[model samples]
Each structure stands twice: as C-alpha cells, then as structure tokens.
Target: ISRQKRTHKIILPCFIGGRSVSRAKSIVNKDGCYFDFPNDAIRILDAMTRSSRDERIVIGKPVLRKIPVGTKIQLPYHIVERNLHSVSIPIIKSNFIAPRQSTPKGLRFPLAAKAVVRSVVHKRSSGAVILDIASRGQLNDTLRRFSHMFARKLEGVYVQPMAKPGTELILGYVHDALMGDVYIAGIGGSFTEDVHDIGFYVGKPDLRGAKAMLAQLRHTSIITSIDVPFVAHQIVRLSRLIHRHPEIIELDLNPFIAYRRGGIAVDARIVTMQT
Candidate 1:
C-alpha cells in the first residue's frame, strides 16, 4: 500500500549503532520523515513475524489463589471489634450478652440487637437482625424473643448502641496464599450495589494511596461530609492488622460510619482459622 502523504505525531527514534537516529525525533510536518532498517531483510521479517502475538501478556501481581483451610471459625462481632480497637482503630461499642433480660454497663438506649451468626453478611435471617431498641425493656424482650425463636441458629445476642447517621463504607482486606494481603476500600452499606466502586492496594498503604482509594468513589457527600484523613488513616491502618494477626484470613468492616471529625467501624467480621 502507498499513499501520497501521511501524518504522524512523531517518527519513533531508531538507533543503528548508538547514534542520533533523527534530528530531535522528526515530528509532523508537510512531509513526514522515514527511517531505514539497515539490516538483513530475512532477520527483520522473522522479528516481525514473531512480534505478531499479544505484547501485554505479563503483569506484576501474583495470581489470586485461595488457601487451603483446616478448621475455620467466624470471630464474633465483639471480639472482632476488640481486636480492631486493640490496634487503635475506632469501633462502635458493643458487647455479647445472654438473651435473658441481662444488661451490659454503660450502654445507652436506641440500641440494636444483632444475633451472632456464622459468616452471615446480609439480612439472611430476617428476624435475627433487629435494630432500634428504644428501651432496656424492649431490648430484653427482643433478645429473649430472639433466643427463643432462633435458638440453634444464633450464638448470642450482640448489643450495640446505634451509630450516628453518616457516610457508610466497607473497608477490609484478604490475605491469600499467593497474593498475600490485599487491602481494599469502597463505598458500601445498604447502598453497596447502588454505586459500587472499590480501590485496592497491594502493598502497605500510605496516606497518598489511601487518599487515592477514597477519591475513586463516586459519592460526593463522602468527601464533603466525612473527614478524609480519618477515613484514609483507617485504610492505611489495615496493613498493620494484616501483619499483626496472620491467623486472620479475611477481615470485613461494613457500615464504617464516618462523621465530620471521626469514623467508626460499626460492624466487623473477622474470619480466622485455628493456629
């Protein structure tokens, strides 16, 4: 194929014997410049034939592979909260109590009675997830009823004070066999699927990386309402949790309520195996 004229942004500089291939890389003009491949024609043809395959074949990260497990246990929400708080991460105050009118100290009204279940993320068991308890009387009745109704299904009644309304998020990490620990941050809550955008960090996250993670979200109110540093710091801190607790295979903090000045992980699920 031949044409009278063709325009190019820049003719790619070539080197024959380590010399200036073109005058400052020939650029678009009235007439485009050309370079000669001064080599054996058979060799150039062979190289071109070999280069016909896909070039972008290799990527840097390790392949995601699931680890083989022996016996896994779903860590309770309170225990998860305690572990997270032990690392200076803020979590909503909660306690596991028997469902028999017993109360834990310093818990205020308008609480929630979340039944402890194994790896149940959503409202899989409708009645087990009860929220907005106005009084201790109501809480006790709800707990007792929950125990009676979902006896074998639940481990215990997890009571927590309702979190203040704010921007909700899902921040978590997964330690895989091949990929090691992959930290993630995203917009999540009841509206997780509504505008799903997640950012992943493979290495130890710094403030810059965490900021980029939060910036990838589509929700504008997340940036305007919550303290970005508070949330970004939360994401950066997950790297420590991964290192501190190697036994934890997966850690999920859903509905991470973010206020103007501070944020708290309202619910956490930590999956660990016996070590």
Candidate 2:
C-alpha cells in the first residue's frame, strides 16, 4: 500500500536497508508504496486490513516477547470501602448462626451455621471457591475440615454479608504480536460465554479508550442505565486499574457488581504471566 494511502495516522521516514530515507509523498500518490514496516506495526496492519483507516501511519511501540513479572497487586475495583471480613460476617451470621443471636468470629457459626468463603476469581468449583453458610453447626464443622484439608490455619477467613449479583467485566493485558503491550477487556465468569462481551486496544490505555470499548459491549446498559451507583465511574476506575498495572498478564473479575455508580467484584482472580 502507498505510504500516503495508508491511513493509520503514523508517518515514518521511509527506510532503505538500515538507513532512513525520505520518500516524496507525491511519488507514491495512489500507487502502492511497498516497504517493510517495523515488526511493531503488525497489529495495526491487521486492524487496518479488517477496517481501512483514513489517517497515515500509526507509530507503535516494539513488542518484547519475554516480559518479566515484578510486584503483584490485586486492584479491587469493587469493595473499595469494605474488606473481605466485613462481607463474609453477615453471610455467616445469617446462614450459619445456630447459637441464636450471633456467632463468634473465629469459632465459626453455631451448630446449624454454614461455612462461606468468597473467591477472588470466578471458578465455580476451584481451589479458590467460596462456600455458603447455612447453620452455625455446619459452619463450625466445615471450618475444622477446611483447616485439615488445606493444612493451614484459616486466619484470613472473613465472615461476609451476601450481596446481589451485578455485572461481570474482564480486564487484563497480554503480549501483542503487533502492538507490543496490549490491554484486554472482556466479560467473563459464569456468564462469560453468554454475555460474549470483550474488546482489545493498543497503545497506553486511557479513560477515553476504556469507555469507548465498554460502549461496544452488548450489555453496556449494566454500566450506563443500571440503577446502581458509580456505574460509569467504575468502568473508568477499571480502566485506571488496568492502566496502572502493566505487569498483569491476565486479570479476571467474574462478576463486577454495578453498585450505584461504583461496582464491586463478587469474585476476582488475577494471574501474572511475565517473562
């Protein structure tokens, strides 16, 4: 394709061998100006092939194959004000508190209580699965069993109050063959297959791109029209979460509940895949 005809909005001083050479735009005209573009432009080219651009070239960063993993952090898009212990307590008291009035925190629920744990990511029956409490008795019985099975003291266990299900959003990053570092945004977990909401973008992630991608989703209503607080704000927050974490290989929030304008993740899991 003629460099002038290429509408990626990125321009390059045409290169000859290893040396950069300036090409006269008039010479290329409508005729194809075929030259090898840096490997970093592959994704841009692919996107263009799928859809033509009106701009010139898009300067893109080179991709590195072996990405090194560094510090890890779980950016809780939801549950900003509360902790795990807070949410789990109510669930324990209501479901398992058999001793009557209330159940002790560490000792577990009463005789008829159930044991509940919240997962960071949505995997129906995985190691990080969270259980529901029914009675105090069940809570106590299950606690011992869980401790024995895991062979570790359940110190981090927190009693929680059950909340209604909201929306699910997938946010993360992956190596892009063309655009170097790329961010991934999708909808997943129990309803991932059903929702089928996902989008990808090159270059540094920003609020503009994030909102644009969310608008493309079929269920954007959950974030725009939902009767929750911080609906749109959370989406922007999610974009910021991903933008801040460049080391994250993949981050999954099964159900990102849209609470007013801000949403909370009922469950979440993040995997760091660095070179």
Candidate 3:
C-alpha cells in the first residue's frame, strides 16, 4: 500500500473598510497557501501599508511630489495687494497704513466707528498687535504707544471691521495624488485643536451630502440653530471652487462665522502650486 499525505488548512484575516473582519480560508496546496483580496480591499490595504511612509497621505488620493526650494510661490494669507486679488470671497475693507508716515491733521479714522484694529507687524514675517478701538481717541493712543517700537521692522497696519460673534468653523481642501481632492470641515477657532472635531469627504459633495456630513457632528444642534442650509451651500460652493482651480493646492478658511441668517469667512489662507 502507498503512504497517504495529510494537508493542513490555513486561515487568513480579511479587512473590510478599515476594520479587520473574521479570518477566511485560503487555498492551501502541497507547497503553500494563497490569500485573495477583492480589488477594493487591495486599494485600502495599499493605503494602510504606505501611510507610515508619507505625511500627507489621503486614501484614494495620489501621492504628492517633493517641492523644490527657492520656488516663487504665492501664499493667500498675506496682506499684499497682489495676493488679495486672487481671493474671490468678499473681504473686510483694509488698507496698508505706511510706516512712519505723518497722520493727516483732523483726519477721520479709516475704519468703522465700532471697528477693531489688528496691527500685524507688516514685515515679511512677524506677530500681530491687536487693539479694540471704539473711537478715534483709542486708535491714536494705541498706535502712538506701539507704532514707534515696530516702525522700522514692520511694513504697515491693516484695519478692518470687527467680525460679529458667531459659531466658528473651518473649511478647507487638500489635493491628494490618488484621491484628486479631499475636503475637510470641522469646529474651528481655539477649540479646533482641543476638540479635534473634524470630518473628511472625498471629492465634491452636493448640498444633500454636505447636510448629512454636518449632521454627524456632536454639536449638530448648535450648527443647525445658527443656519445649516446656508453653511451647506457655502461648503458646496467651496468644493466647486477647488475643483475648478487645480493651481490652488490648499485652502484654509478658519473662524468662518456662522450666524442665524448667514456666515462670513473671518480669515482665509490659500496656497498655490506656482513656481
């Protein structure tokens, strides 16, 4: 009689979405076991494996190439006139008050009556000096005290109306090599980092989808009471803007004030892929 060979069965763990599912049997032969993964699962697995190697990895998005040094790039945050022209959103009226320039005799204040002044040390880089001025007297007093100290190193002062108090949120997007475009939304302001209340959506989301995403937030009541439909519309608009402009690599609208009737972007920063 011939001797019989025994075969051992092997089980492999499978993953659906992100969580690991129950182990499935693999095709076992005399030589080895073979595990097969669905096409969608393969993509997810690839992303998970490569995540450690990259910093800005977004699943379904393509990988980004290294940026070269000394490139002439444009940043959206600066108060320069050239940079301001690129932004489409309505901005608070602002001006560059020249350094060491003589103030006009009996000149009216440039900003509104109740407006606040934020004096950013207008160099290529520096910190901001914020002052709440309800009248001309306070404005002159604040500037007289601090202007001389920052005059040489600073560029100019920027004055704008004080934004109304409201629920703050952040809206932005990043270009993923594999995903194309990924939109990010979350609670903003000082609580942004502390709370970590954020959500991500791949590609553009319609109004209905945007509403659903917002509904998932823990602070849904606060958001809805302020104005859910208006905010959702703005998200859709932002998504379309990102899709139309490939040159825009990143967009950050922080402290987006959402009120009972509407909303406004308090601060905006955009980065372009220009050389």
Sorted on TM-score, highest at the top, how do the candidates line up?
Answer: 1, 3, 2
Give the per-residue lDDT of model 3 (tens digit) for 1-275.
01112322112222222111212221121222211223323433454444424222121111122223222123312222223233444445443343443333343443421111234413122334443456666666545654555655444444556676888887777877799888777897656777878777787889887776677678766766678888787778777666655566777677677889987775666665532
As for lDDT, the candidate ahead, 1 or 2, is 1
List TM-scores for all candidates, in order: 0.67, 0.45, 0.57
How well is each residue in 76-160 modelled by candidate 2, as lDDT tens digits?
2112212222222111222222111233544432222122232223334434334555565655555555455444322223344
For residues 1-275, could you state the per-residue lDDT of candidate 1 as single tens digits?
Answer: 01232431212222232113234223311132222222222332344345444322111110111112333445434346556875788987776564342566567889977776544557424566777899878987887777787776555666788887888888988877787778888887766666777777777788998888788776666788889999889887776776776667788788798889998887887876534
- Supply every candidate's count of residue pairs whose N, Cα or C atoms clash at under 3 angstroms: 0, 52, 9
Off by over 4 Å in 2: 1-122, 125-135, 141-159, 175-178, 184-186, 220-245, 273-275
Clashing pairs in 1: none
Per lDDT, the best of the predicted structures is: 1
Better of 1 and 3 by TM-score: 1
Off by over 4 Å in 1: 1-69, 104-106
RMSD of each: 25.4, 20.7, 22.3
Candidates in descending lDDT order: 1, 3, 2
